[model samples]
Target: MTVLDIDGIDTYYGNSHVLHDVSLTLAEGEVVALLGRNGAGKTTTMRSIMGVTPPRRGEITYRGEDIVGKAPNEINERGINLVPEDRRVFPTLTVHENIVLAHKLAADPRPVEEMYELFPVLDGLRRSNAQNLSGGEQQMLAVARALVQRPSLLLLDEPTEGLAPVIVDDLRTMLQDVVEQDVTVLLSEQNVTFAFDLATRGYVIDTGSIVFEGSIEEIREREDLLEQYLAVSPEEVA
Candidate 1:
């Protein structure tokens, strides 16, 4: 069943068009990857789904209900949560405080103890301020905060953008655990290894359009397309 449907979305930033006739779908319990370079409108597509950047023309349906033009919080309340690109944790807040703040907005929120189990380091630094945490810890906090919402559909935007390889691997495992709980994931990622490893299917975006959509194997077979759009060979990372 389709849990999220984005049909013919056209989004703009001021007068600049960022998403052009973009479309994708996410099935219940499935993980879909959005792959592209910087400025390829990957983040814009995510923001559009969250209603942070409402599409000027398009239909965004969640669980058969139209969500276009709704406010961000309204959309979020409907079971969609976003882990934004920059790991936007409140610097002044303690790690525990950050999770608690998220819980305030969450429905059936996860307990701090459960979050600690998912991210043990968070347990270790529960009293420390967010700004003092390392990059990996902040990323984990970001994911943990969103998970606290108990969202049915999670939108993760570049979750491993600047983390070390070890941290990225840890995040991969965490995402694997999330999907096991039957949450649908639509992840925007530039790291092909992470994307392909975590997602069975991927949609490749270039300029402002989806140029390819296929299984991981199919994408792996298309080196020419990968090089043309992403600029780096996945084999190098592999």
Candidate 2:
């Protein structure tokens, strides 16, 4: 089953075009990575899907219904949630409070205990102020908050953008666990190694357009193509 379909979407900001003819599909229970550098259409594509900035032209079908012009909250209510790159946990709230807030939006949220189990550290620091947590810890809380909503499709934008290498490894493990729980993920990342390791298939975008897309094995076989388009050499990820 195709959970989400973005076909030939052209998104813009003011007069500036951001995403050009972008297209991709996410199958049920599969993890797909959108790979690109800064200023590439990666974030724009995500924003377009969430209807944060509705696409100017094209089709965005979620579970077989057109959602191109739906409101952001409406899109989210339909079981699609985006954990933006900024890790926007409410600073003044406690870890537990942050998770509780998401429940207001979820029609049928998962148990709080499930969230604690998925992120054990959050359980220990349930009462701690979100502002007091470390960068990686904040990221974890952001993800946990989203998962508590029990979204069928999770959109993660640059999830490991500024984390330490060890933390990135831990996040990779956690997200793999998410996939196992039957939540499909569309992760946007510039970290080639992390994306390649977590996603079975990927789309490489450049300057608001898709340049390449295929299985990880196919990408591996074309190191020259990766380097030429993404400036990502095999050695960097290897």
Candidate 3:
């Protein structure tokens, strides 16, 4: 089943036209990557879906219903969640407090304790301020907070940025667990290997348009495609 269908969306910021006729779709339980370099409109695409930046033209349907002009909270209530690249946890709030806050706001949230099951490291730091946690730990917290809302579709932007490889691996394992829960994901990432690991398919976005869409296997095999868009070699991507 199609969880999301974005058809020829043109998004803008003020008078600046950013996305031009960009389109993509997500099936139920599929992890699709929006691959791009810096300033490549990946986050704009995500923002458009979540209603932060409503597209100027074209259609956006979540579960076959039009959502082009809905508010962010309204869209989120419809079971779509977003984890922004900055890992927007409340700095002064405790780890547990963050989850509690999100839980209270969620339309259909999971139990707060379940977050510990998803990220055991968080269990030990439940009492600590979010700002005190390491970058990776904070990233985990951000993801945990989003998942506590029990969203049907998750829009994750750059979850692996600035992380150590080991932490990325740990996050990958935890997210593997998330994928098994039948959650559909639209992952916006510049971390090719990390994105490749979690995504079944990828859409390469450049300057504001989707240039390539294919299975992970097909994307990996195309060295020229990788270099031209992502600026990575075969070994780095794999």
Candidate 4:
């Protein structure tokens, strides 16, 4: 079943045409990566889905319903959640408080214990201010908050952009757990290795257009394609 179908979306930014006829789809229970370098319109594509930047043309159907002009919160309420790259958390709120606050935003919030079990480190830091947590911990918190929304489709933009290698490993594990729970994901990432570990399929976006779409194995075997579009070498990803 297709959870999301973005067909020929043309997104813009105040007269600047950013995305040109970009398209992709996510199936139920699948983790797909939108692979791109900076300025490739990955973030813009995500924003357009969430209705933060409504597309000027084409259709964005979530579970077969047209959501192109819907408000952001309206789209979210329809079971789509976004975890942005910036990892924004309540600066002064305690870890527990942040989790509790998310319940109010969630259409169907999960139990607090479930969040703790998925991220045990958060359980230990329940009393610490979000500002005091490490970068990786903050990223976990951001993801946890989004999960509480009980979304059917999750959109993650550059989730591991700046993290220690060990932390990235932990995140990969956490996301694996998320996938096991049947939450479909459309992940925007620049780290080929990280995406390889988590994605079943891939879409390569360049200069605001999708240039390649195929299975993960296809990307792994095509070093020339990766280098030409993503400027990545096989050794770096391997």
Candidate 5:
């Protein structure tokens, strides 16, 4: 089943056109990656889906319902959540407090214990303010915040951004568990290897348009494709 569908969306910010005729879909329980460099409209695509930045044209449907003009809260209430690239957590809130806040938003939220269970390191620092947590911890808390709401479609933008290799590895392992649990994810990333590891299929966007999309195997073996679009020519793709 297709969980979310974005067809021919043209999202703009003020007068500047950001996303041009961008279209993609997320199947139920599949991890789809949106690959691109820094300014390739990845975040814009995610924001458009969450309704933070509604598209000026085209249709966005969630489970066969049109959601182009829905408010962000309305969209979120429908079980679609976006963990933005910034990892925006309430800086003053404690780890436990943050999870509780998100739980309150859900009509059917998972227990607060589940967040701790998924992230035991967070359990150890339950009382620590979000500002005090490490970068990786904040990322985990951000993801935990979204997951606690028990969303049907989770939009994760650059989950591996700005962290040490060890933290990234830990996140990858945790996400593998999330995949096993069948959480439908649309991930946007500049980290090619990390995204490829989690995504079976992907769409590559360049300069606000989709340039390539296919199975991971098809994209993985093409060094020329990676090099021309992503400037990632090393053996990192392997």
Candidate 6:
């Protein structure tokens, strides 16, 4: 079943036209990656879908209901949660406090004990301020917070951007767990290895437009296509 259907979306920021007739569909419980370099409108696409930047044209249907021009909170209430890049945890709040805060507003919050099982390290640092946590811990907190919402559609924008290899691996495992629970993920990422590792399908974007869409195996086999658009050799990274 289609969890999200974006048709001919045209998004803009002020007078700057970004996405041009972009169309994409995500099925229920599917993990799809949005791969693109900087300035390719990946972030814009996430913002548009979440209604932070409403699309100027086209329709955005989530769970069979039109949500094109809805407010961010309204869309979020409809079972779509976004874990934005930079792991935007509240610096002043304790780890426990942050998690509790998210739970307070969650439609169907998970138990705090369950969250601890997902990220065991968080159990020890529950009272620590978010700013004092390491990058990986912060990322875990971000994911845990979003999961509290029990969202059907999760939008992750570059969750592995600046973390160490081990931490990235931990996150990948966590995401794998979420995917196993039948959560649909729409991830925007520049890290090809990370993207391919977590997602079965990918959409490659360039200069605000989609240039390629296929299985991870297909993209990996097409070295020429990857280099031409993303300017990177997957072999070098592999």
Which portions of model 6 show Cα errors greater than 4 Å?
Answer: none
| lDDT of residue 180 for candidate 1 | 77
Per-residue alpha-carbon lDDT of candidate 6 for residues 97-124, written as tens digits (9 for 90 to 100): 9999999998787787788888888999
RMSD of 3: 0.9
lDDT of 6: 0.89
TM-scores, all candidates, are 0.96, 0.97, 0.98, 0.97, 0.97, 0.96
Clashes per model (N, Cα, C within 3 A): 0, 0, 0, 0, 0, 0
> Model 4, which residues run further than 4 Å from truth?
none
lDDT of 6 at 236: 57
Model 3 ranges off by over 4 Å: none
The Cα error of candidate 5 at residue 124, in Å, is: 0.2
Residue 106 of candidate 3: its Cα lDDT? Answer: 88
User: Which model is ahead, 3 or 4, in terms of TM-score?
Assistant: 3
RMSD (Cα, Å) for all candidates, in order, is 1.2, 1.1, 0.9, 1.0, 1.0, 1.2
Question: Residue 231 deviation, candidate 5, in Å?
Answer: 1.8
lDDT of 4 at 50: 98
Per-residue C-alpha lDDT of model 2 across residues 91-207, encoded as one tens digit per residue: 999999999999776899998889888888788999999999988899989999999999999999999988999999888887777778869999999888888888999998999
Least lDDT summed over 10 consecutive residues: which range in candidate 3? 174-183
lDDT of each: 0.89, 0.90, 0.94, 0.91, 0.91, 0.89
Best by lDDT: 3
Give me candidate 4's TM-score against the actual structure.
Answer: 0.97
TM-score of 6: 0.96
Q: Which stretches of candidate 2 lie over 4 Å from their true place?
A: none
> Better model by TM-score, 3 or 6?
3
Off by over 4 Å in 1: none
